[model samples]
Structure formats: structure tokens, C-alpha cells
Target chain A: DTAVSQTPKYLVTQMGNDKSIKCEQNLGHDTMYWYKQDSKKFLKIMFSYNNKELIINETVPNRFSPKSPDKAHLNLHINSLELGDSAVYFCASSRFRTSGNEQFFGPGTRLTVL
Target chain B: AQSVAQPEDQVNVAEGNPLTVKCTYSVSGNPYLFWYVQYPNRGLQFLLKYITGDNLVKGSYGFEAEFNKSQTSFHLKKPSALVSDSALYFCAVRAQNTGTASKLTFGTGTRLQVTL
Candidate 1:
């Protein structure tokens, strides 16, 4: 079974277009996270939710918002997408909201804004 | 703030030879280090981690890493390099005492190229 999964593996849209990427995890984990990887392969954490509660919110812009309906799902919505939003976004899950836990990542959603 | 550094942008190795990818980290307190691998167009795969206990940690795909507190490094190593092992590797660190909100910081990544 696919432990962590994300919808729309590839997305191509124009500037000012709004988009949303959905993520789900079946590992029975209590924590979920969102990460962004740039063209240079630099990965950074964008947001994290533990048991449906917002736990970590990095220095991401207000245009980026993350919503967690439950413990198993965390979705990202980008408003007024700009050219700088062209990159791969990854969804991850861990056992808990602890630093020692290793996160399981999904296949990732490649978002390209023209 | 926790940060990780991977000095080499790419490491080339021949098949059947051993390979090593260096990594260093800095944090205010103890660190939870991890190694992840990314194949072409794929997400990051957890290879190994060092939270506590033994300094040497063994992970998937015949990969291992040694954590050195004195040097603040966790270098990934493999006994034999395979052609399929060519991929981008990332080193990440999380500060243990930074509460539950602490996030994992990743390095720029090192591309391992294994040639025949």
C-alpha cells in the first residue's frame, strides 16, 4: 500500500491562477508536514500539522496556506501563484510531532507557473 | 537555528568501489541527523538517521552513516557502489531541544554519480 500519497503529480498553470495540492497518509501517523524543493534541489519545510493542529509554520508567504481536515490529510492551497512558485512540493508524515521521528514523504507534486 | 552543510555538489564513484558523501551540521543542542535519497523525479526517501544510541547508523539500500559529535558531522557511506545508486542525497538536522515545532533543516544536496 502507498503509505503517503499526493494528488496531481504534475501541475502547470499560468500566473495569478490558484491551485491546491492534496496529500494523504495511511501510516496512522499523528503529524504531517509540507515541504518545498526549489530548482537547485534545496528542500525546506513550509508547514506542519500534528493531530489536525498547526504546529510549525515556517516563513512562507501568506499566499501559501495549509489545511488539515484530519490527522491523515493535509492539503496546500496557493493563491495568486507567481512564477517563483514553480517547484516541487512534497507531503510528509511522521509518527508524532517529535524531532527524532523520521518523516515518510509522498511522490511529490511538481508545480510550474508560467 | 539548526543547519546542515554538504560541501560537495557532486561525488563521482566507479562501480564496485566504496562511496562517501560528507555532511556537517550545527545546532544549539543535541541533533537528530538524517540521510535521505532522491532518484530522478521522485520524492525524498529516508535512508538512515541518528537520534541517539550508537553513533553508526545502518539504513536501507546498504547505506550507513557515522555521527561524530566532536566534528559535528554525519557522513553517508556504502560498501559497494552500484550504477543504480546514482542519485541526489540530502543531509538534514533537527535540534532536539527546540520543542515540537522544531523543523528539519536540509542541506543543498549532493549528487552521487556512479559510473561503470
Candidate 2:
């Protein structure tokens, strides 16, 4: 069974448009995260939610918002997609709030804002 | 302020040869280190981790890592690398700033190319 999964594996939209990507985890993990992988293959964390509560909010722009209706799901919404927003988005989950827990990741969503 | 660094951008090895991917970290308190692998067009897969046990930790796919506290390093290693072992490897550390459920700081990543 897939532990973590993301919807719309590929996204193609025009600039200034809005888009939303959904993520779900079946591992019953308490923590979920959103990451952005740039063209340089650098993966950076954007947001993290623990038990549906906002835990970590990185230096990301306000145009990007993450919503976690519950611990099992976290969704990312982009208000105004820009050319720079074209990258691969990854979702991850981990159990417990411990320090050394391993995170499970989902198949990334490739977003292309033309 | 926790961070990890992968000095090597790429490491090439021949099949049946041993391989090593170097990783160093900096953190306030004891670190929680991890190693993840990513194949082309796939998501990151957890390979191994170091919490607070034996310095040497074994992980999936015949991979292991040695946690050196004095050096603040957790390097991934394999006994016999296969061509299929070629992938991008990432090292991450859990930040201890918040004292709560902390966020992970990842390294730049090292690409492993195992040739036949």
C-alpha cells in the first residue's frame, strides 16, 4: 500500500493562474510536509503541519498556502502561479513528533507555469 | 540552526565495488540524521537513520551508515554497489530549535553513478 500519495502528478498552467495540489498519507503519521524541488535539483521545505496544526512555515511567499483539514491530508494552494513556480512539489509524512523518525515521501507533482 | 552538507556533487563507482557518500551536519544538540535515495522521476525514499544507538546503522538494500559524533558526520556506504544503485542521495537532519516537532534540514544532495 502506498503510504503517501499526491494528486495531479503533473500540472500545466498559465502564469497568474491559481492551482491546488492535494496530498494524503495512510501511515497515520502526525506530521506532514511540503517541499519544492527547483531546477537545480535542490529540495527545500516550504511548510510542515503536525496533527493538523501549523508547525513550521519557511520563508515562502504568501502566495503559497498549505491547508491540513486533518492529520491524514495536506493540500497546497498557489494563488498566483509564476514562471518561477515551475518545479516539482513533494509531500511527505512522518510518525510521532520524535527527532529521529524517518519520513515517507509521495511521488512529486511537476508544475509548469508558462 | 541545524544543517547538513554533501560536499560531493557526484560520486562514480564501478559495479561490484564498494561505495561511500559523505555527509556532515551541524546542530545545536544531538542530531537526528537520515539518508534518502531518489531515482529518476521518483520521489525520495528513506534509506536509513541515526537516532541514539549504535554508531553503525544498517538500512535497506544492503546499505549502511556510520555516525561519527566527533566529526558530526553520517556517511552512507554499500558493500558492493550495483548499476541499479545509481541514484541521487540526500542527507537530512532534524532541527532542534523549536524543542517540539522539529523540521528537517536537507543537504544539497549527491548523485551516485554506479556503472557496469
Candidate 3:
């Protein structure tokens, strides 16, 4: 069974288009996170939610919004997508807010904006 | 502030030879280090971690990592390299003191190529 899963493995759209990527984790983790991997493969943290509460919000633009309806699900919604927004977005989850726990990652969603 | 650094962008090794991927980190307090591997079009797989224990930590797939606190480094090693081991490796660090350190700071990543 896939512990963490993300929907729409690949997404290609034009500039100004809006899209959403859904993530679900069966690990019953309380803390979930979102990371963006650029063309250079530098993974940076974008957002994190603990028990459906927003915890970490990096320097990401306001155009990107993360919604966590529950502790098991966290979805990212991007508005007015631009060329710079093209990258792989990954979802991860951990049992709790501890540094010792390894986060389980989803397969990642590759977004291409033209 | 917490950060991780992977100096080498890529490392090549022949199959059957031992392999090493270097990683260093900086944090305000104790660090919880981790190694993850990602194959083409796949997600990151947890290899091993050093929270608190022996300096040498063993993980899945016969991989191990050594935590050198004095040097602030945690390097991943494998006894024997396989072509199938070719993948992108990432080093991450989380500050134990920072309550908000639940988020991991990842390095730029290192591509390991194991040639047969």
C-alpha cells in the first residue's frame, strides 16, 4: 500500500491557469508538508500543516495556497500560475512534530506551465 | 538557522566498489540528520537517519551513514555499489531545539551514478 499519495502525477497548463494538487497519507500522521523542487533539483519547503493547522509558511508567493481539510489530507492550490511556478511539488507526512520522525513522501506532482 | 550542504553535484562509482556521498549541516542546536534517495519519476525513499544513537547508523538496502558531530557531517556509505543504486541522493537536517523544526532543510542534492 502506498503510504503517501498525490494526485495528477503530471500537470501541464498555460500561464494564468489555476490548478490544484491533492495529497493524502494513510500513515495517520499529524504533521504534513509541501516542498517544491526546482529545475536545479533544489528541494525547498513551502508549507507545513500540523493537525490541519498551518505551521510553516515559507517565502512562497501568496498565489500558492495550501488547504488541509483534515490531518490526513493536504492539498495545494495555485492561482495565476506563471512560468516560474513550473516545478515538482512533493507532499510529505510524519507521525508528529518531532525531528526524529522520518517524513513519508508522496511520488510528487510535476507541473509544467507554458 | 538550519541548513544542509552537499558539496558535490555528482559522484560516479563503478559497480562492486564502495561508495560514499558526503553531507554537512549547520544548526543552532543538535541536528537530526537523514538520507533519502529518489529514482527517476519517483518519490524520496528514506534510507537512514541519525537522531541519537551510534555514530554509525545502518539503514535499508545495506546502506549506512556516519554521524560526526565534531565535524558536523553525516556521510552516507554503502559496502558495494550497484548500477541500480544510480539515483539522486538528498541530505536533510532538522534542528532539535527549534520547536518549529518539524520542517526539514534539504541540501541541493547529489546525483550518484553507479556504472556497471
Best by lDDT: 1
lDDT of 3 at B7: 96
lDDT by residue for model 2 (A13-72), tens? 999999999999999899999999999889999999998999889999999999999999
Q: What does candidate 1's lDDT look like per residue over A1-114, in tens digits?
A: 999999999999999999999999999999999999999989999999999999999999999999999999999999999999999999999977555899999999999999
The stretch of ten residues in a row with the least summed lDDT in candidate 2 chain A is A94-103
Q: Write the residue-wise lDDT of candidate 3 on B3-73 in tens digits.
A: 89999999999999999999999998788999999999899999999999799999999999999999999
lDDT of 1 at A48: 96
What lDDT is obtained when candidate 3 is compared to the true structure? 0.94
List CA RMSD, all candidates.
1.0, 1.1, 0.9
* lDDT string, candidate 3, A1-114, tens digits: 989999999999999999999999999799999999999999999999998889999999999999999999999999999999999999999977555999999999999999
The model with the greatest DockQ is 3
Candidate 1 vs. true structure, TM-score = 0.97
Residue A30, model 3: Cα distance from true site in angstroms: 0.6
TM-score of each: 0.97, 0.97, 0.98
What DockQ number belongs to candidate 2? 0.72
TM-score of chain A of each: 0.97, 0.97, 0.97
